[model samples]
Target chain A: MYKVKVYVTLRESVLDPQGKAVQQSLSSLGYQGVEDVRIGKYMELQFDDSVTDVEGTVKEVCEKLLSNPVIEDYRYEIEESAKQ
Target chain B: MKFAVIVFPGSNCDVDMYHAVKDELGEQVDLVWHDADNLDQYDGILLPGGFSYGDYLRSGAIAHMSKVMAAVKKAAEAGKPVLGVCNGFQILLESGLLPGAMLRNKNLKFLCRTVELSVVNNETMFTSLYEKGEKINIPIAHGEGNYYCDEETLAKLQANNQIAFTYASDVNGSLSDIAGITNEKGNVLGMMPHPERAVDNLLGSADGLKLFQSIVKHWRDSHVVKA
Candidate 1:
């Protein structure tokens, strides 16, 4: 079995409103010198080891379904399961 | 003409869309489930606003993969008018039928209010009834309606006159103040506003009625016998 860990974030060119809001809240809470905070998403997927080209398949899935290329970017790490 | 208002599991605007088309526009309109196998009988397709799949993965993300989306895509390729509003707009973008994607509102709030929209391109079937630069009142309700596209795509849209509407005032902090845009062929339109909700004067705005009229007008004009 393969365990895929994916991270997705809004592109730098696109505004991160939710992240910005959180940054403001942090400032109000007495944090100092906080430069900026950009929020993102993390996803995990499990696939059977019978699958080949695991990396390539994950890449295609990320581009097609896991992320919006127009506004977000994504990268994934695949790890083999000890059980399988 | 017949219209199909696609109803996803969590779609909230399908009924409003149906009312606008059947009672207000005086046309045949039906609510089609997202699992339907075909859409060939419809003259136009409408994807209404609401949280489909409870907006699980992303706005319009999960719904784009629904069974009926393929039929909707085919309808678009067949040159039938396809309109996506609010969540519908997000679906169109997620499906890649329209360029650009949506981000959270700049204020990070769920905004639901009426705003004025200026018709940037009145030549398209969706806006032909309105004069260029004409402002219409429409209600926008969504949390993620900030539209974003690359500079190159923006240049192409401007060159093609594909931008259909711009908010007279920046209501959602959308790039270029864009509220609605059409595909290269102008048959597919995706916007953040709810025109169906504005069709009745009882709701305090009938300005959006012209948009429905424009669609009917264009369809009729194209179906006419050539001289």
Candidate 2:
């Protein structure tokens, strides 16, 4: 088994609407100095395959389908998990 | 042309896109789920609209990191045409497949209505069917569809004629009233309107079908007949 984590965010230079909305709400609630806010996502996955090639598999998946290299970016680390 | 429609968890328009591609162009089409990684099989990829992941975190932000996105990136890099509609547009922005980002409608309410879009550029794979300066009505359904970008990037996009579609009227306060944009290479396109939903006259208008037809025609014109 392998555990994987996915992180997705807007490109560094892109503006974030949701994040800006939250920042506006925060300021209305008496917070300050929040120059910018960018929204992102995190996902955790557990794969049942225990093949000898783990990292390469994860990387392949990440590069091929797991993350959109355009606006969102993702990286994953794999660790062997005990089989049930 | 062979086509594939990506179906993320909250993708609502994958079937519509599939039918639009198949019924309109009579092309081979497939529904690719978010978990699949291999997309080298298709000639074109369509990221359909919908509230992926229930619009959690942000529109398209969660879906951007899905496994299928990796395949999307590869297909795009290989110069295959990719189209993103509505939430799919947001995903493209979140995924960095296209520049600019989505923001809440300036009115702070979900806007669902027909919108007028002027064809700013007719040279992209997605907009080739429309004549330059032509105006078409397409329905938009989204809470966060306002597009924002820095001035420098916006200027560059404008200079390159990458702005494919612009709102004829101020709809969501998108910067420069941009409704759709194409990548510099014209292989990737993202628009915040639900073109697939408008492909059939039964649904509303058939104007949207022109987009799919354009993509198919371009592929055939470039690869099959030309070759």
Candidate 3:
């Protein structure tokens, strides 16, 4: 069995309005030292032991659906589970 | 010409599209479900606006994977005209039928209003009825209408004359003020503005009606023989 975690974020070159708005709110709340804040998505998936290539499967899902390559970048971490 | 208005879950503008083609343009039209895999019968395909799949994951992201998208892609490859407006445009971008992806509006607000758009390239089948550089009023309603693309893609789009319409003034902070663009072949168009919603004078501006007329005109010119 395997557990995978994926993080998808807007590319640095792409502007993130939501993140900027949050940053402004933080500044208003007196967090003057915060220079930047970028928003992103995190997803978790569980796979059964039958799945052989966890890394390949996670990459395929991220590239094909979870994140759009045109404006977003994605990275994933996979961990093997103890047999039940 | 027969047209198909693809209806994905949460698509709210399909009826407007259907009405524009059927009643306003006097053409045959039907509302097609997103799960259908065939789109060979339609001369033109319309993907309307609305939060598809509840805008989950991202606007148009989930909807792009629907079964109907394969048919949409097939129709586009077949050289049939495919028009996607607002969320529909987002779907086209997500599906890779168009070059750019949409970002949240620069102002971070859901904007809904009519704006002036300049016809950048009138030679394409979708804008042939309008004069070059003509300004038209179209209503736009979306939060993620800010279009983004790499510099190389922008240059290519410019060189190929694939840019169809640009906002007269910056409305969404889109790159190069691009309001609409067509595929390299000029057969598929994805735009933030809702032309279907402006097809009648009662809808505040009939400027959008000519777009549908232009599509029909092109189809007739190519497929119908004048005896």
Candidate 4:
């Protein structure tokens, strides 16, 4: 079994309005050295023993549905799970 | 003309769309569930608003994958007019039927009000009844109406006259104040404003009714030729 952790974020060229609003509030609260902030989504997927190539599946899913190619980018890490 | 309003599980505006078609426009319309795949008989397709899939990942992200969308794409490719409003607009963007993606409104607030829209292109099937440069009132209700696209795509949209409507004033911080746009073929349209809700004077403005009328008029004109 493999456990995949996927992270998705807006591309650098795209603006993150929510993240910007949060950053402003943080700065007003006196958190110094805050250069930038961008909001994103993270998901953990569990692949069963039947799945042979974890990386291939993760990449396909991310590109096809998880992350929108026009505005967002995603990366994932795969780790072998001992449970299954 | 026959119209199909694709209803996703979390869709809240399906009734309004049906009302606009049957009651206001006096046309044949059906509310097709997302799971249904057959839409070959429909002359036009409508994707109504509200939070599809509760807009979890992004607005319209989940609903775009419905089984019915395959038929929607086929209709678009076959040159059938497809109209998407609000969340429906987001779904069209995610499906790549139209270019550009939506971002949260710059103010990060859910704005609900009637906004004035300037008709940017009237040659398309959706706006043929509207006069060029005519200003109309349409209600907009959403959190993610801010439209974004790369400069290259923007240039292409401009070149092709794909822009359908622009806000008379900056309402959601959309680039160039774009309120609605159509595909290059001009068969598919996606807009943040709710034209279906404005089909009658009781709802404050009847300017939206002409849009539906225009779709039927164009479809009837072309279909009659084949017969």
lDDT of residue B81 for candidate 1: 97
Q: What is the interface RMSD of each candidate, in Å?
A: 0.7, 5.3, 0.7, 0.8
Q: Estimate, for each residue in B119-220, the C-alpha lDDT of model 3 and write its tens digit.
A: 999999999999999999999999999999999999999999999999999999999999999999999999999999898889999999999999999999
For residue A49, model 3's alpha carbon misses the true position, in angstroms, by: 1.2
Task: Give the Å error, residue A24, model 3.
Answer: 1.5
User: After TM-score superposition, what is the CA distance of residue B218 in candidate 2 from its true location, in Å?
Assistant: 0.7
Score each candidate by Cα lDDT: 0.93, 0.84, 0.94, 0.94
User: Pairs clashing in candidate 1?
Assistant: none
**Which regions of candidate 1 are displaced past 4 Å?**
none
Winner by DockQ: 3
For candidate 4, write residues B1-227 as lDDT tens digits.
Answer: 89999999889999999999999999999999999888999999999999989998878888988899999999999999999999999999999999999988989999999999999999999999999999999999999999999999999999999999999999989999999999999999999999999999999999999999999999889887763
Regions more than 4 Å wrong, model 4: B225-227
Candidate 1 lDDT, tens digit per residue, B35-138? 99799999999999999989987999999999999999999999999999999999999999999999888888899989999999999999988999998999
Task: Kindly report the interface RMSD of candidate 3, rounded to 1 decimal.
Answer: 0.7
List residue ranges in candidate 2 displaced over 4 A. A1-84
CAPRI class of candidate 2: incorrect
User: How does the DockQ of candidate 2 come out?
Assistant: 0.10
Give the lDDT of residue B6 in candidate 1: 98
